[model samples]
Target chain A: MKPILEIQDLSVEVESKKVLHHVNLSIQKGEVHALMGRNGSGKTSLSYTLMGHPKYRVTSGRILLDGEDLAGMSPSDRAKRRLFLAFQNPVAVPGVTIASFLRTSIRSVRGDEVPAKEVRKLIREELAGLGISETFMSRFVNDGLSGGEKKRLETLQLRLLQPKVAILDETDSGLDVDALKAVTSRIESLRSPDRSFLLITHYQRMLEAIRPDVVHILMDGTIVKTGDASLAKEIDEQGFQSIHEASAQL
Target chain B: MSPYSTTTRSTRKNRIESLPIPSRKDENYRFTSLSNFNLQQLNPSIAHPPKTVEPAPEGFQLAACTYPGGLAIALESSSHEGLHLSPFEDAPEAIFQKHRAAFDLPQALDADLFANLSAGRCENELLIHVTEGKKITQPLFLRNFFPSTDQAFYSRTLIILEANAELELAQEFVWDGIESLIQPFACGLTQIVLGPGATLRFSTVQNWNPNTEHFSRTYSVLQEGSQLTLNEVHLGGLKNQTRHLTHFEGRNSQSLHTVTALAQNSQQMDFWIDAVHQGVGSRSDVEVRSIAQDKGQIVFNGKIRIEPTAPQTAAYQKNPCLILSEGAVIRTLPKLEIQTDDVQCAHGASISSVDEDQLYYLASRGIPENTARTMLIEAFKAPGLRGVSNPFTKSWLSKNLALTEEEQ
Candidate 1:
């Protein structure tokens, strides 16, 4: 079985500041990987760079999705290739209804128009699955939505788009325990032998709920340590300082 | 000779001379060169008047009030009653004279050669009267056709609504395919009076022939407690200039103005919007969006003014331009003038190319780069186009902005 995504020596720079040094990580098909890091540790930068954010320049290295070079592809193209980034702060596109936006996205990604009735049915099912009401589908995307609602909306898109590899940026933030549970269950349901996830987060609470197959501690742009899901529990109990000390000894 | 032409040419010189250019210092003309266009060159000429009065084109219809008498009587009475009942005809001549003076009417008039075929010809003007407490169910469609390249023609429209009346009007401009370039000018002054509690939705589609140069001016006045929404679409032209002005004169009046200009392949468009909040508690919102490609040039200027007496007035103006080609030029000026401390006024102007992140986001979704750029541009203009009330017009605009299958 081939890896779903591979990041080889990915060095990223933003605004002339080196945010990600020589970093490397990979996720095999159907695996859930957790990228844990402190504030300003380049976890989000790495995700954005992989998603081809204009500001996050890949100073050096390559990003491959299913053996296809994704360094120069656009976010939309990346999205078509089954790549999704549930932004920590989703942009508010005023005057665009959620239904219309999703319809456009589906058409652009699939290169074919989905009948309105069918799309509506699909959206309704996806919204229900994410614990969102049908009324939410008529409102503008991310406009005036509560933080939790926005996160669920992202999950709704994940379910609708069914991207092969989803890089969720801090989706656990701002979600209540119930919302977190729902989100975790949705992520768990999406887990399969062919689909993969690169969950970038700072807290271990979410990981405890949706246990990942592998946990990588990212610090200063590089993945300093990789281990089984126990690594998350160790970081939760001992904090990152102990990990830094242990790495120094190693 | 038609009465209009006989009187038009003889009085043309006097009218041009008597017309007053409101001083550039005037609050309305401030920040705009009101007299930049040379009006003297626009001499009234009837030598090549339209040879025939062509029938209305396809996809358009016109209907007027049905009187007990024959069509002639109905037409005559309608024209007489419309012209006389117009509040604009009763407005202080000083205001009309001011606009006439500042802008060269004849020169700015469309010079399309096809207009000559219908020269001295007059189409039956549709008279719409919304009585107090009356609401119109069907949108009135006014379509004008200039079928010949041999001459110039003129069309006049008058719309009046009584107090508490609600109406929606859609006006479309279409030119026949002329073998030669057409220079036609349509002088339209649509006067809408919202009696206290009245509301109106007015939309215009200016899709002239690509070989034609078109000019038009639309002025609207809102009475106290009345509301107005004006949507303008510009899709075709060699050289097109349009001026849309809205005045909120009654206390608590409100106005929303939106303009979308899509220029491609060396087309030049100048779109100007002027909104005046003159009554206390009056509010105005203006938005202009333009997409220019292939060395196209688009000029967009939006102004909002809050008078001193209009305390608690709120006004906002936004002009954003998307340039798809390196050589395309977009000049945007968004201005706000507030004389009352209690008023809220804000203005923003931006000229930017496509966003890389947005592009990448779309491309990664399997959409190519060019298709992504086109989609982003459409998204950028969608906000302004959403206000269009006519479904056909909205779909037309969508088709114009959609990415081709090959491109996708």
Candidate 2:
């Protein structure tokens, strides 16, 4: 089957400095792919480029979602196409409440006004499943939230949005053990034939919870190796240095 | 008949004639100039009675209504106990003698020409009084109607709350017609006095025509254990200048002043606020929030003073402003003159544009760029507008906030 999302030789630049050079990747339907890299391996750069962040310039190649070129589309447009990015660090909006923000986003994405009561009920249910307090509905978005709470909120959005392709950029970094279990369980439950996920992380703990169909090792803005889940175990036993030495020999 | 005697009126007119016209060179008028106002339009006359009127909000009684030419009429001798309104010319002799100073205008014409101009041209006024220990259940509402004319209007108001009394009051300006060919100028003074252990919540909203000019002054005095809350919203006018002064006279008194304004087009708004702590253990809080678009300009000068005799006082001032357009300007000066070592005083001011990262975050959530910008601006204004004391006024502000389009 054709891939659900495709990145073709995407060379990205930020502030006129080349960040990602000639990168290519793809995720088929229902498959979870793990992209592992060391620090400064351009994992975030790839995620931002896919999401069409204004700062990340696409110097070459194109990102296609469902065979549609996302070249000149805005982030909002990409979001309408069921593309989601779980930010590693969410920005704080001081006076915008979480409930209002969620309602607005749902309405915007669907291009219609969902009934307030129905939206409220959906939000309450998702929040309860995530173990977040109801009082968080009134608090400002991400303001004064602990790192764990921020991740949980992001997971709640992921469930509500139910995007076709989700880029989880280091979502496991700040979560505690219990929260990690809960988040991974939700991600596992969300797995289906129509959904795809690109789980980006630096470690193998998250990979252990939800096994990936394939794993790719990213080094210096390029993917060096693509193998089954065993590649992650190999990297965990040795380090990226061993992989770098092996790739250099090729 | 006018409340002021002839001799007093003549002296005020003489002062208005003798004082030099304010120029931009003056420090107080540095950012503002009188060139936008037509000084020759000062013929104060009585307003023609309106053919119809808008009813007051539920749970509120119309205390008084003023027309374009400074004519104030008592609207309702309310059935609510302890509520009263009297024309300034017809106040009871004893009550008049007791609180006469609260209605007088400024003596320093050189420092306050506009106030003196209002005082010199004043025709009629209103006095709102609550008797001692009377807790008014219903809020008293005051309405001012501005007629479509080229003439300038002036008015005076005095409010007195006896010891242990409680009152809630609101005032709003209403334009008489849908449109006007000429812009009318408005000048008015309002003074409030709270007796020992008294409480008062006063709200005022000014949404005038964009071409109109307005000058307003409010001076309040708080006695022992008294509490005063003042909420003001300004969303209109061409060249608007307002002054607010609060005197914390008696021990343990408290006051809160909140102001929110929106300036669009070429509108210019100047606000001066002062809080003087004179009694021991008094507390005061002053907050101002404003948004400017197009070439709109806003100036806020806030001062807090703690006297040596007033030990252990707590005073705070905060002013936050947003400039939506590159040409828009916000100039704020927060001053603290603290004489006592035991007092706690703090002030802060911030000016910024819409945050880019915040916008991107919202946009990523599927909200359109325009919708995200409006949402952020609304959130920035929520905390300030939430301080509005009157429900009707609050509703009006909310409705107009959306309708007031950004001037291109």
Candidate 3:
């Protein structure tokens, strides 16, 4: 059982200031890992670095996807290698329609053009599952969409792209209960033998439904605790401060 | 039988002869240089028509005296009743003589010296007139295929749309391998008269090879309640200068001017657009989007004027230029002159490279760098191109855009 996605001693910096420090994390194939962190805890920094965002500099350490190093590779090349990132704040490209962008991404990743008819059908079915109307397919990519709608649209991409490893950064935030449920069910549906996921979130509400196989608490740019699902529930009840105090006392 | 008559041609030719060659001192000539194009090399005030027509040439389908393909290919119009085609000599008296000052070339030509040169030297030009109340559904396409660029030439087109008449006019220029054959310059003038409540959608694609310098002028006057939409697409030219003027003369009339410029390699593009609101409650909107790559140079001069008596006038002008590389130059000026106290007017101009966030976002979605670049450029230009209501013209632009992408 080899780890499908691994980040070894990873540190990330943005604009000459270090935001992440020596973070070690790995998710084996078919396993779901939840990264819990407070604000400024560098959760997003780690995820973006993994996706090869040009703005985030990987100062040290290596990001491995299926035993291959991802550093120096472009974001698009990483995407072609089946590594996907669900942006927390999705970019709004005003003129690109959702369906066209999706089809283009599919063609770029799959190395084959998907017929327009098939693309429309898939978008219709996926959007329906997320309770979003098919009209969104005609709209610009995430342009003026509600926060909840942007999250669901991202989840839709997550499924359609069928990446080997998916890193979802704060995807569950801003989602109402029904939307959260829809997203959890979609996450469940995506459960497969070879796929892996790293879900980044702070609260335990999302984990209650998706039920992560492992939960890690990241604070001040480094992972300080790695535990089972019960640990997430304990932190949710006791809050992160008590654990911080307990760890400091150790 | 020529309605234009000999007197008017000589009168314009005299104007050209008297006016010294335009220089940087002329405000309208602004950033354009008088030396690079070498307009002086041309016969200062004469239009030289083709000596021989070589069966539509090697590539393009030459616009014949009459055509199943000439007008049909350019305008993409199916109707024929409202169609009028002539070689200047046979223009009708009522159309040519009735609106003596009604056409806009007279007033617009004063802005530049070359325009006067073109008018003075023009010969055997085409004059088109659309009758009142007839909706010409078929588009009118003027496919100008220069038989040979051995000498300098200038052509003229006069269009009059009567009240309630409708037409979509398109112009496409093609001279692929004839660049070296081009001597000094080639020019054309199109004057339009939009009758009260008439509607016209005009589009132009300027693609001239590197050898020929090109200049074009379009001046249109709209009557009361008339509607006008004009799209100027500049894609290829060695040195190109186009001046467009739209006068909103009628009360309650609306006009939109959209321009798209693509200047690549060492080519130069200068575009001047003016929107004049004279009628009460008239409104106008002007927008330009340009892309300059390699050593291409581009200039956009846009102005909106609200007359003293035209109250409640609303006007806006926006020009955005995208620079793709070093040595690319862009100069833009957006001006609003409002003599009326009660007016809403605003203008903006900016030159920038492709947004990094936009580039990264597309790239992260698995789009290759080349594809992303092409996509961004197309998207940046689409909002303006979508204003093109004529199906034929829009399709032609889309096909040409793809052709440009492949050329890159």
Candidate 4:
């Protein structure tokens, strides 16, 4: 009955440029909320701000995860609290293998050292679920991986971590049809009564595969419209110009 | 300023017979001023051998032992069959004598009062030989203990490896609690002849006390198809200077040299490394990393020279220094002299503080600023330490790094 994540009057600024202006959003448990916006529409900024990126300053607002204030909490602390963000552009950390990084992340979040064999098993299962090869575990994290491979790796982390709230920013943007289907199926499998997701994307193609309970149209750093799944289809047919006109009339 | 009135000329004729004249303006001694140390004036007292042999420290084991004037020594002792143990004694007519004469012996010698005393007292010299087609499972650990402050110490080691020999040697220099000034000199000459395929890993951990001024000179000659790796970790010193030179004479030889220095307080450290590639298809890599805090000062000059005859050679040198305090000073000069056009040679030197972005990233993860800084330092130094082949040496380096972090 309670909202899984609540952002009240969230405004984010990066280096004197206002990216997100007074954006209010909430997603209830078991609900797939799609945040639709054009390029530079502040959708990714909202996701990063919620995840506590140091570069994104919250000028005024509060972020609540399961009713607990996460306004000033660190990204690692937030991660420990089961908050995960699938970065749109994942940074490559040299000399840190994917296996070791995943093991460290899991141990830091779980507060217990898992055996190497168990860690390898979990990584294998997660990678297999995402259709990633075993060789991916030995490579450096996000190093020399293609865009589609990086996205799948993000999904691999999402599956392995199983965070309470996942903010996946355009994870299906560059994915092929098969990859899109696999990624969508992975997201669909993670849908649970106690879990929530904030999927930020510009394409309605992803929504057709993994249906959303609610769809919101955002323009110029603010959310303009909120409606049901039919709204996504309506926008797919009419485009965002008609929605802008309709919102202006209101 | 008469020609014969110079210090070297007068000393050569009156005090000592035929002292080699060393030019002070040499590039090797450019940054370091030897005038202040005054090595020639302080005549150290001779050291007597210890009454009883002391047990080695923890994490260290003795490989082979030889009594005084013994014919049937270990195979490793054969390399130094004709090496003179003392500089004051008449030089032998062996390969080691020729190698010693090639350098300015008197200037390189540590004749300080304490060094002479320790050299006279420490009679146990080690000779390590790596036979052809032989691989040592454990690292040969040599512990040189300076328990007395009344005498200076001088130790010499001769290491040789035949073709296809692989070995790891770790030497630790420790000076117990002493207030008197001590100068310990260590000179090591290693000849590695690689028959088709051979590998050698050498690591040194110098933990001299604040009162000791340590000087070490190491020269290694690699033959055809050989590989040599050297690692130096300097954790403690008052005034320390080390010179390491590697000459690649045979084709297809390779060398990787890494030096890590962590200095605090008023300690001064200077390191000079020169790698000469004389053989075609040879490769050389040099990396020097240092961390200076308090008022410590460190100077590192690394040079990689490729001869005209040595075509198709590859050489890379990098020296990076991290200054933790405003008072700390670090001077790094990474030089490359390539005579041949068909060579891949590059050098880089970076002197920087901690990265602010990485700090913020770690802090946002709930790690405190100090803890984050430590993590970043560990990450920066971990690359060089991970390349260590010996697990015990790697662990030892990790322990030293932790100690440095705590001191900071």
- Candidate number of the best lDDT: 2
* Prediction RMSDs, each to the true structure: 6.8, 3.3, 4.0, 6.7
Q: Model 2: which residue pairs collide?
A: none
**In model 1, what is the error at residue A241, expressed in angstroms?**
1.8
Candidate 2: where are CA atoms >4 Å away? A111-116, A244-250, B1-11, B28-30, B36-38, B57-59, B70-75, B106-110, B388-394, B403-408
Steric clash pairs (candidate 3): B45-B121, B46-B121, B47-B121, B74-B141, B75-B139, B75-B140, B75-B141, B77-B138, B77-B139
The top-ranked prediction according to TM-score is 2
lDDT of model 1 at position B266: 79
For model 3, residues B82-101, the per-residue Cα lDDT tens digits are 65666566656776677877
Candidate 1 TM-score to native: 0.79
lDDT of 2 by residue, B64-111 (tens): 778766554555545666766776776767677787666566442235
- Residue-by-residue lDDT tens digits, candidate 1, A1-250: 6688999888989999999988888899989999998888888888789877778888899999999989777676688788888788777654456766677677776554466557768777777788788778678767899999989988887877888999899999999999999998988898888789988888899998778999999887878999999998888888899877766776
Candidate 3, residues A63-122: lDDT per residue as tens digits? 888999998999899999888889889888876777778888888986654664576677
Error of 2 at B273 (Å): 1.4
Error of 3 at A107 (Å): 1.5
- Between candidates 1 and 3, which one is better according to DockQ? 3
TM-score: model 3 vs. ground truth: 0.91
lDDT score, candidate 2, position A169: 89
- TM-score per model (chain B): 0.73, 0.91, 0.87, 0.76
Q: Which ten residues in a row have the lowest lDDT in candidate 1 chain A?
A: A108-117
